[model samples]
Structure formats: C-alpha cells, structure tokens
Target: MAAGIQQQNAAEDIVIAGAGLAGLAVALGLHRKGVRSVVLESSPERRTSGFAFFTWTNAFRALDALGVGDKMRGRHLQLQGLRVMASSTGEIAREMDLRVNGKLGPHEVRCVQRNVLLQALEEELPPGTVRYSSKIVSIDDQDGAKILHLADDSTLRAKVLIGCDGINSVVAKWLGLAKPSESGRTATRGYARYPEGHGFEPKILQFVGEGFRAGLVPWSDTDVYWFFTWSPAPSPDANGKEDRSAAAMNQFVLTKMRGAKVGPEVLEAVERSEMSDVLAAPLRFRSPLSLLFASISKGNVCVAGDALHPTTPDLAQGACTALEDGVVLARCLGAGAERGFGHEEGEDRPCLGDAIVGAGDGEERERVVAALRRYAGMRRWRSAQVIAASYAVGFVQESDHTVVSFVRDKLLSGVLAKTLLMMPDYDCGKL
Candidate 1:
C-alpha cells in the first residue's frame, strides 16, 4: 500500500474507480453534463476477457442518455424472443416474446461484445480521460475529501469518490461491506466465431436441465456467445489446477451435454470457440437485503455497479442495472451542480467554473453530501428488487429437487418468463 501523503495540488471534483462499464459510463454521463471526472482503471489496458453482455431496452435507454446508443446498437445482433427448452429432452418448452409490451419503441434484447461496448464508451470520452494501470491500494476520508493511495506510490484527493470496481472491489471493502458470497454455481462462457457467417436467426436459445442451464445468443452473422451454468462437483483439491485448454474444456462441456436435448448448432458453436476464450468462474452475489440497508456512501465516498449490487445473471440484468446506476448517479450530481451544490471557496473543480459563485465551503460540502445520499436513496430499492428477483430466478432454475423441478418446469417457467419479459422499462430522466 502506498503512503497517505497528500499531494501539493488541490482535490478533484470527482474521482471514479474501475474503468469498466459502470465507471466509464458515469464519467461519460458526467462529461455530457459538463462535469469533469477522472477515471482510474487497475488493468493495464481495456479488458478483452469478457465475451459478451445481453443488453435489454433499459440498458439501451441508459446508453442513449450517455449519447452512445446508436453506435453501440449498430455493433451487435438484435433478437425478438428467447427459445426455452427442456435440457433433458431438448424439446421446445416455450418462446417468450421480449417486446410483448412494446413500451421501448422497436428496441429488442441484443447481445453486444463486452470489449466493443467498452471501446465505444472510451472513444466518446476526451482523450486521456481514463488512466490505466492506476490501481487504488487504500482510501482515506479526510476532512471533506477522499485521499486515495495507489499501488504506483502516488496519491490523489477528490471531493467525491465513486467505486465502480467489480465484485472483489477494494473500495467496497473499505466501505465495510462484506465480501461477495458464492452462489454454489459456476459459469463457463465463450464466443463462437465463424468467418463464413453462421446462418442463424436472431433469437436466444436456452436449455434447462437438472442442476444446469445453458444458453446461446448470436451476436452477429459471424459470431455467437454461449454460456453454461452448473453446480460444481466436489473435488479433493479445491485449488487444484484443471485443464483449461480449449480442446479440453470444449470436450468437457460437450460431454456434459452429450445426452441432452441441445441442437447440433449449439454443439458446433462450442466446438468453434478458441480454448483461451472459454473462461469459467464461480458465480457470486451480494445479499439484496444487505445492499438495501447498508450504507453505500459515507460522506463523499460511494460505490456503484458490482461494487454496490452484485447479483446472479439469471435475469440478465446485472449489466443493465449497472448502466442505470451510472446514469442516475450522474444526474444526481449534475442536479446538485445546477443547484449550486458543489462549489467551494478558492477551489477549482472542473466543469463547475460558472456554478461555483456565491456558495460558502460549508454549504457546498453539505449539498454534495446530500446529492450522494439522494443517489443512494434512488438506487437502493431498485437495486434490491433486481438482485432479489435474479437470485430467486436462479434458485428455482437450478434446483434439482423433484418438487421444485416440477414447479419450475410445469408452473413457474411460463408465469415467470412472462413476468420477467414484462419488467418495466426504466428511464433515468435526463442529465
């Protein structure tokens, strides 16, 4: 950890941690409102490991607010509905139309490559906005500002800090939040590429089996993203190295689905994936109740995205909700600035030059804190509901008990799928 020695310069208006989806989106949102923020990323460069994200209309609305919706929409494939099937027999269970409500114009569920989205967000920002390789080691809430200690032996002070780091966020730990709990399931995801183009319709194909679930979504004519989730089998050595070679993992996944009802196209997609691209990890989520009641921000230090509301991907709302957080948080801060809330005496915070007049230091700090609290208040219940729903969906889908499986297969699947499809679209107002 770097020492907490303060630098000679003045504090920044806002400093965001983790330049992933949430962090970069917030920065871009703030920029659109004429509020400047510094984004710090721990990684040496943009992440390429994440294969793809299933983005819905709500996420697209948030992106549109940040002014990158059309560009992002053009880079992916759109789907009208999902094909649910029985994993054991591979029989078509149901087809749930995604646009049943028709509330989001013509927008439908789409799958975007994660790196492509990140790059689009990065490109929208001014050059040099994101500082890579700048990992934070420690944070101290001093007086009315946050002092950050980076692993590179440097320090920075900001009036407000937003932690958009993922599940293992150092900033969340500093906020006294418990570590994320594993969901007792593991996920393996990869992208299947075809230079010759895959002749597949725009739809998501999902299969549910005992203690396992699998899905495939065509990202474009040439690329498709696939995922499998299953309860892990006990191993004598928990930390033992397993073969991660593409051929080995592909074989492992194929063997698991060998007698299942999956189609030949699904098998072919997995076989086409590069071994290095097939990544697996244990799924984890933060308790929604804890997230609802916990203090996400103390003074000017706060957290967002997975750092604030990590949940299972059963509902495919994790990324969508994170995008919502960025838009809402930026709007709150921008509203505060409009109300003369972020100014201070003799302090030069970017993007608030004209709004700094006539506010005392004490008054400014009070309003800034108020803005952060409002951000938390607005997000708390919304995030809790999504987290809880996602967890419940996962529980029912993954249960192998005879009674639970019967309820899921016969009753819950139809009702729950429709209810999920009818989930109201969210708009974060405007910046």
Candidate 2:
C-alpha cells in the first residue's frame, strides 16, 4: 500500500454514521474509554426532532455510565407512577405505582426532552468530533477498510464503521437486512407549554379507547409532552407522501379525541401544541424473528440502535435500548482492541486507535471483526426480546375486541403493569 493511502486510513480509525442519541452516546462512551472516533451526521445541525421519550430505569443506568445521568435526572421530575384511564369514561382504569425499585433500587423514570438530551451528549464530545452535513450516500467494503461515499462527492476510509442511523438506515440496507414493515399505526407527538406553570402530578397519564391510544407526561413545571397513536394508519396525501403538516396532524389529534372522556388538561395539551413542537410518523419495526438471521454485523462494519433493531414504542423501551446499545458496543470494541493487540506501553492498556494502527493487517482486522461480532452476539437476543414484548403489549392493549379489552383492563391490568415495570430492569454493565 502507498504511504499516502496508509496515512489517510490512519486518520480515520473509527467512524460512526448518524449523530443521533445512539451515535453520540457511542462516541461519548468511546471517549470515556480513551478511544477517539468521528461521527458523521447528514443534517445541517444537530437534529432535535424526536420530541421526547420516557427514560426508564434501564435507560438511566446507561446514561449514568455515559456520565450524563445526573445532569438529565436533575432536569426532569421523576414520574411517580403510571395512570391508565378509559378515554370514554374519564375514569382512572388502573394505577401502577412506580415508587418501588424492586432489585434496581428506587425506581427511576422521567420524560426527557429529546433536544436537551442531544445537546448534553454533544457537549460531552470533543470539539469537531461530529461532522454535520457529512452524509454517506453509499458504502463499500474494500479489503479490510470500509469505503464510505459521502453525498458531497467526498469519501472516507475507516478501519471500523458503526452505523447508528435510524430505521430507514442506508447502512442497514447495505448489510442485506430486511426492510422494516409498518405496524399499521401512526403516532403524532408534541409538547405543550404553560409559562404560568402547568399543575400536574409527576405521573405518566395514559388514556385508551377502541383502536386508539394517547398519553401525556409532565416534562417540567411549565411543559408537558403528549402523543396520540391510532390504528389503520393514515394514507399518503396527493403527493404520495406521509402528510407531515403540523396543522393537519395537530387538528387530527383534536378531532379524533373530541368526544372522548379524557380530562380537560389532556385536550388543552394537544390544542396548545405549536407547529414547531409537533412531529408525526408512521410506526414501523423490523420483525423480531427476522433478527434471528439478520446481518447485524459483517467484517468490521456493524449497526446499532434503530439501525439494528427497530422496535415498536409500545414498551417505551426504544430510546432505552439504544442507550444500552451504545454502552455495550463501546465496551465490546474497546475490550477487543486491548485483548487482540498488544499494548506498547508495557502494562498500560493501549487506546483502541493506537491498538489498530495497522488495521489492514489480517490479525488486526480480525480483532475489529471479532469485536463487532461480540456486540451483535450480546445485543441480538436482548433486542429481539424487547421487540417481541413491545409488539405483544401493543397487540393486547390496543385490541378492540370486547374480550381482550376485558382481560387487559380488568383481569390482568395489575399483572401487565408489573410486567411492564420489570421489562427495563437490565444493566448495560460498566463502561
């Protein structure tokens, strides 16, 4: 190989695609491990469009490991419990207490704003770690290096490539993984602000009706995050595109729940949502069974977060699992480098970058490949379980059948609540 070629590849040791929560968290974790990595983001700036998500105990554990747990926890109120209500009767159908931690200790759950979360992760990264507007149009595996073709007509060569892009990931497709299928549902999410102070207890308040579901979580004293999901997903508009007009989606939420027996606060929350705060999407997930044979990783390239396992939001574990993915992937890669390559510093552990200098070597390449395989091996089953459970929970809770509703609302509500609480009781291990 030419000296210039080797130098170019040396400067690109580890490169991660997409700067979302998963991508940024991976970068942050690698930094903590003393491994440097560059993140590529297609957007012109940091994307803050995901709105917010419920941060369960498992997510907080990963956040703590990423060094932002205290910062995030300090910003949002810990939700006390979950309130399930019948949208028709305006009466609380069930109350699931979340105060007890079981084995995880003082149960921790909070509704975290996506913008703030992204900001926190970015702050932890070294300056210029993320290259925005640097989109990867295509990828090719050449020899031991991954050749990334960017949209700007530039190219990058990396010893290791981690794809943390979202559901419709280019990286996932290149790896020959099956495309995600729709869940026959659509969700509209938004936040409402009350400068004067919105008075609501710190509880995840949810309402359900035939073929529809909605929920609200107080984000802070002056803000609340809410969402509406419905079955028989909406059709594309004249342009043959999912209509994302904030006005349309906002009005749709109000019209769908006009006659429902939900509280006035619920109605007002949706009504107060500004166009800027609203976001809409058709729900989609990669079948868990397909994951059984999915190419989560190939050679030194791998996928993480939604790129690897796009699960339904029924369990509210989407973000949490992504957080878990970041830590696990970092640990696997960092450890693999140390174990496979001898550190030159006598007894001290070498940085992943330093360990993989001659990454083109057969033995060095094998080390990176093994690291990715370990990541896939560790996360594949765990992710499949979470995906399947989310689907099952959604199937039962959203079922319109009279008998199923009876079983869900009465016979097994408590059991379901306990089960849901226990779903996120995982530890991502120390970073």
Q: What TM-score fits each model? A: 0.91, 0.92
TM-score of 1: 0.91
Question: Candidate 2: misplaced stretches above 4 Å?
Answer: 1-11, 235-243, 340-360
Q: What is the C-alpha lDDT of each candidate?
A: 0.79, 0.83
Span of ten consecutive residues with least summed lDDT in model 1:
350-359
lDDT per residue (tens digit) for residues 1-431 in model 2? 00112122334778899899899989998877767788889888888787789999999999999999999989999999899987756677789878786675777899998889999998998877888887888987665577888876778887788999889898899898889998988888999999999999999998876667899999799999998888876667898876768998988788778867777788899999999888888888998988988889988788999998898888899999999999999898778655653222333665445335353455666788888899999999988898898888777766767888777777777776877887788888878
Against the true structure, what is every candidate's RMSD? 3.9, 4.0
Error of 1 at 10 (Å): 6.9
Residue range 1-431, candidate 1, lDDT tens digits: 11222344345678899989999999988877667787888888888877898898888889989998898778887787888887766677678777665554654679988899999999988776788888888887666567788877778877788999899998899888767898988778898889998988889998886677888899899999999887764242356965555666677778777767778888888988888889877789888888767888877778899999888888888888898999999998887776654433343543433122223356666666788899999998988888888888877776677888777788788876855664436666666
- Number of the top-ranking candidate, with TM-score as the measure: 2
For model 2, give the 10-residue run with minimal summed lDDT.
Answer: 1-10
Candidate 1 achieves a global lDDT of: 0.79
